[model samples]
Structures are given as structure tokens and as C-alpha cells.
Target: MRGVEHSIQLVPDYRVHHQAPYRLSILEATELKRHLEELLRLGFIKPSNSPWGAPVLFARKADGTLRLCIDYRGLNRYTVKNSYPMPRADELFDRLEDNRFFTKINLRSGYHQIRVATEDQPKTAFRSRFGHYEFTVMPFGLTNAPATFQTTMNNIFRDILEEYILVYLDDILVYSRTLEDHIRHLRDVLQRLRKHDFYAKLSKCRFAQRKVNFLEHHVSDQGLHMDDAKISAIAECPVPTSAKQLRSFLGLTSYYTNFIQGYARYSYVLTSTLLRKNPPWFWTPLCEDAFRALKKAVTCAPVLRLPDFDCPFIVTTDASDFAVGAVLSQGKGVYQFTNKYGANVDGYSPIYTPDEWSATGDTYAAGTQGLLLWAVTLGALLLGGALLIFNTSALS
Candidate 1:
């Protein structure tokens, strides 16, 4: 107990809300609050003061306990924008084609390690009753912190930038197939960080491994997978009761829209009904068809390979009463959804005679089909143009 007490004393009980006498009511919340109070009393935890009277951000002490933190959202609004180059998701995934191993590393207390430039340190001020305390290290909720940190890291690893690497704030990923290759990559990463005086907490980092989760995607020898958590979220979706609910469902599916073929047509009917004010919720045969079509699309989704700029693109497109969509798919198996949009289609049937086809229907169908075809042709031409540009420059 004495040793435990001494360890607690070393952990600072900083003020909360930028002031001393940090008060927390253990009585009102009872269960959870009591847990916090007990930890504080045992010296296992302390208050974390924020510079700008915002909420404090808490970190797990060497001892397992919760600490109070202030919110710093207010001060971060005024920071300068960070002009860092962020990696595109598809671009990052493309590099993993040959690799069967993956590893994810997260920095422990990432922002806390870096000192905010002394002049800018004063800007992170927060008000509290006891007194104001400023952040000795970079505080959370800063607008520019992410970009700044990312840029700093990029510079540190610039020498080996061509290798497989992705950095998002404190998270760094290294990918390779062989154990030996991964070890070499990890060594290079660590050595560069050392050269730049950037330290990482090993406890929070996972070194080269067969599979890892990054940005919620499960990456492994099998390739990238939709996160189970995301699947669960989709599963929890309530059945559509109105056009609004249906639209929300469509939006969710659209987040993984690339995985599905003809996604726009699949979601067309449901999306159409939602655009009108006070629209009645009608799950007609068309709506049911669209809904089932979307679900089926996911189940049969193709495994697309990565795109190579040198390869030719096989562009495809389709249209429906309400929407037009196109995919810029490459033969190597990789594809990207270049365009999708809702059309102001009134209604149209091409099979109908000139007299039978209503003005509204023809206009809608024509616009939808025209747009879809146009998108595909344009996408193909763009890819060809890009190839030409690159080759011409290379030769020159």
C-alpha cells in the first residue's frame, strides 16, 4: 500500500477546466463517479487541465485508472491550417497488392510528446476557478495539430517514402510480405524517427504481423476486408418506414458504394421518393426490388485488383428512372466510382411508341441514359488521355 501510495503521488493531479480545486461530484453519478473518486483517492489517477478551459484529455496512467480531462475544442479553432499531404485510401491499398502481411502502430499519447512552439503555447489558454494552466505538450483538439504532425513525420521518413507507409496523425502503418522484409521496413522507420528525435511508445505499437486493422479495415494475407464493426452498424439499421429512412439507408450503403455494381440503379427508386416534400412512404414492388437489388449487389461484389496507370481502363455505366452512374474499372481488377448522380427524370419508356411515351418519361429516361453513357465514354477518354500524357512526358 505504501509503494502504491508513493507511485500515486508522482502522478500529477492537475486541475480540471484550467483551474485548481477541480471538483467532481461522486454522489450524483454514483457508480461510475465513485470509481473515479476511489481511484483519485488511491493516488492512481489525477486531474488533467486543459490550456483553454476546454475539457481535459485523459491518458491511462502507468497504473490502470481514469483521469479527468478538460475539453479544448474552443482554442483549436484559431490555429493555422496544416498543409500536409494526406494519403488517398485507394492509393495506399494499391501498394498492398503483393504484400500478405500487415501491421498497425499507434503512438501512445501522440500529441503530448511534441512541444507546441513556445510562442503558440500561450494561445492554448483556458479559464478555470482555481487558476489557468497551459499545456506543456501539444494538446488535443487543435485544428492544425494533425496536419503538422503528419508533415513532420513525412519529413522524417522522406528518405524511404517510396516504400509502403501510411501515416494518419499518430498511427503509422508498414506493409510487406516476408518477415525479413517487414523487419527491415520497421528498422528503417524506427531509425528515421530516432534521427529526427521522434520517440514512439512500444507498448501501444504493434510490430510486423500477419494481419492488422487500420482505419477500421481488416488487412491481412487475404487482402482488405470491411470492418466487422461497420457490418454490425449496417446490420443494426432499422427497416425503412419512410423515404427519409430509405435515403439514410442508401447513404450508408453508398459509403461502401464501390463494392457494389450498379449501385445507383440499385438505390434509385428509394432515393427518388425522398426528394419530394411530405412524400408518402410507399414500399411498392419497385422499392422492394431496389432494396433487394442493393443487398444482392454486396453479396456478389467482385474483388477488384489495384490499378496501374499504364493499363487500359474498361469503363462501364448504367441508368435507371432516377439516377445515372459509372465505374472506371481496370483489367488488373481495381476499380473506382468516378461518378453518380440523381436525374430529374419524370418518367420514360423507350419501348413505347412515340405517342405512348409520355413527355415526362422520355425526358427522364433519355437524360438518365444519356448521362450514364456520357460518363463512361468520358471516363475512358480521360484514362487514355492520362496514359498519353505520362508516356509522352516519359519519352521526352
Candidate 2:
């Protein structure tokens, strides 16, 4: 955040938007005023006379706290996007490599730690019922904020990143195989934070945990497991009354697709209706059955053991005229991949037919018979792309 200022590059002849502030309720007004005072005290923001302005509003959090936010849709339209890539969660998991100990560090007001590039600070000015103000540091909702923040974190931890530390923006996870090693790694991470003048919220930080909940997955030496809270939500969910509701359920379930075999298969009937421009609203018996089956599958999801490259992998795959399904296993399932916020969907593509994904059914096509039983070793394998590693001479 200090070494690199977040730059907000705009496209040519961008239309400057200075929208009027939205009316606030009594509670919102109180919260906004309080936040503005705090931001001013911290020197994170200042009174502005900039021509470019956006509206300020309050966004409700899950815990019901009102978060002061700016509507940046108008400004973002003209802003050039920062497409800096983030490390995938799946690749991060692979690096865990059966580490038995874990420590997670959550930074305090992560984005606020970063300064917006001097020239772009004026462009970040937003108008509120109280007054017009501009941010000195990067504020939430900017188009390039994520990329900027991610770049900052990567640069801060570049030397030790992926050795024992994995960073996703403000979340720094230091993992090690033993308590002794973990202690040293933790110190190193803390020293780095201290060196860079970054601060962590001690209350939100976990130390020497064998199991850690991160990126929506419960990560441990046993690979990634489904989060119980999310599973319970899936279990208690009422049947969907609309397409939007159903898609929400699917999105939640899809995040843990690694733990659920035949996920795409079980979810097909439920998802097919959503593909059409105008999907049928009826909750048919088949859809209900599929829904129940999916819930049951998620609740009973298995622990995806970390893949061992030394072990021989069992590549179980099947295909029908319309669909193909595959499971990468080493006795237990070992799936991989994650971005900052989402899992890779390609590995869990929707199954077109039911029986096509069945693991026990005859895997052969109705009219074909050349069954291949090639060894697929390593965690590097992709679903459709032929993947994996090991000396090919061993097969010979």
C-alpha cells in the first residue's frame, strides 16, 4: 500500500459523473456522519472541491451493520479496469501439501491501508448529504481496487509467498507441517507485517490451528472439506419458488463441488430449467427429488484428501453421447483450483444426462467398447485437458 499507489486509469474522453447524493434515513445519517468523522480523523479522507463526484450511501451487512459506501457505477463506466490476476485457491491448496498446522492473519481495514495515486484521488471524490469528500486511500467499490490491493499484498510477501505463506489480498495464511516450524513461520510473517507498517486485527487472527476455514472451504491436512455452516444452510433451505432462488442455492452448492461426486449430474435437472430465457416456474416432483438428492449429497460430502504425487492415481471417467464425467482419485477424492472469490467451474461442468455420470454403471457407450484404463497420476490433471505428471517410462 505504501510502496505502490493504486492507480485509477480511465479510458479516453471519459464522461465525468457527479451524481446527487441519495437521501438517507435517520440511522443511515448517524452512521454516515460517524464514519466520516472517523475517516477524517484517520486522514483517510478529506473535504473535496473536485468536479467528479458519486453518491454516498449505506450498504447493510449480514450482521445488520450499515457500511458507508459510494455508488461508483458512473465513475467505473469510464475507468479502465485493472485485470491483475489473483492466485487460484486450488493452487494454494496444492501447496498446503498435508501441512498439519495453520495460522491465518486478517489485516485491519485492509483497503484503507493503501493510498490512491495522488492524481486519481480527486476522481474518487463522492458527495454525501453531509458534504463532498475525497479518499486519500483506496476505497471500496473502485473498479481497480481489488487488483491494486492484490498487487500490493503480492509485492509485500513476494519473497516468502508460497513457501509457507499464502496471501489472498488481506488474508495471510501461514501453514507448516509442525508446531516448531509453524512458530518460526508465524514470526517471519509477523516480522514482514511489522517491517511494512501493516497491522493485523488480533481478534480475527488464528494461531496454530490444525483446521482453518478459508475461502469458504475448511482447509486442513486432509485437503479441503465443506463448511458446516454452509451445509446446514443448504439443508434447511426451503424448496425454491423461483429461478433466482434456485440459482442462489446452486451457486452455494457449487462452491463445494469437490466434496460432492456427481455434483453436475445431480444438479442437471435443477439447472436445466435455468438455461432457458423463460424457465418454467413449477417445482416438479423430479426437481424436488433432484433437490433432495443434492442436499443429501452435500451433507454427506467426503474429506478430499491431499493428493500424493508418489501414489498411483485412479482416473475414473465415463461418457455418453451427450455428456462426460470424470473423478480424479487416489483412493479418496482430490480436486483442485480456486481464485480469490470463486472456484473454477470447468472442473465441475454440468452433466447433460443422468446415467452418463454414474460411477458404477457400465461406462461404455451403448454402441462402443474401447475402454481406456490409463494411469492418471498427480494433482495437476485437468478435467477434459489430459493432465498429470510421473515418469511415463513406469507405464512401459
- Top candidate when judged by lDDT against the true structure: 2
Query: Please, what is the TM-score per model?
Result: 0.61, 0.82
lDDT agreement of model 2 with the native: 0.74
lDDT of 1 by residue, 19-78 (tens): 333343453234345544554474333453434355333444436565545455444443
Candidate 1 — worst ten consecutive residues by lDDT sum?
Answer: 1-10
> Which TM-score value belongs to model 2?
0.82
**Off by more than 4 A, model 1:** 1-52, 55-73, 83-85, 126-133, 197-206, 220-223, 240-252, 266-301, 308-311, 330-396
RMSD to the true structure for each prediction, in A, is 11.7, 7.4
Predictions in order: lDDT: 0.53, 0.74
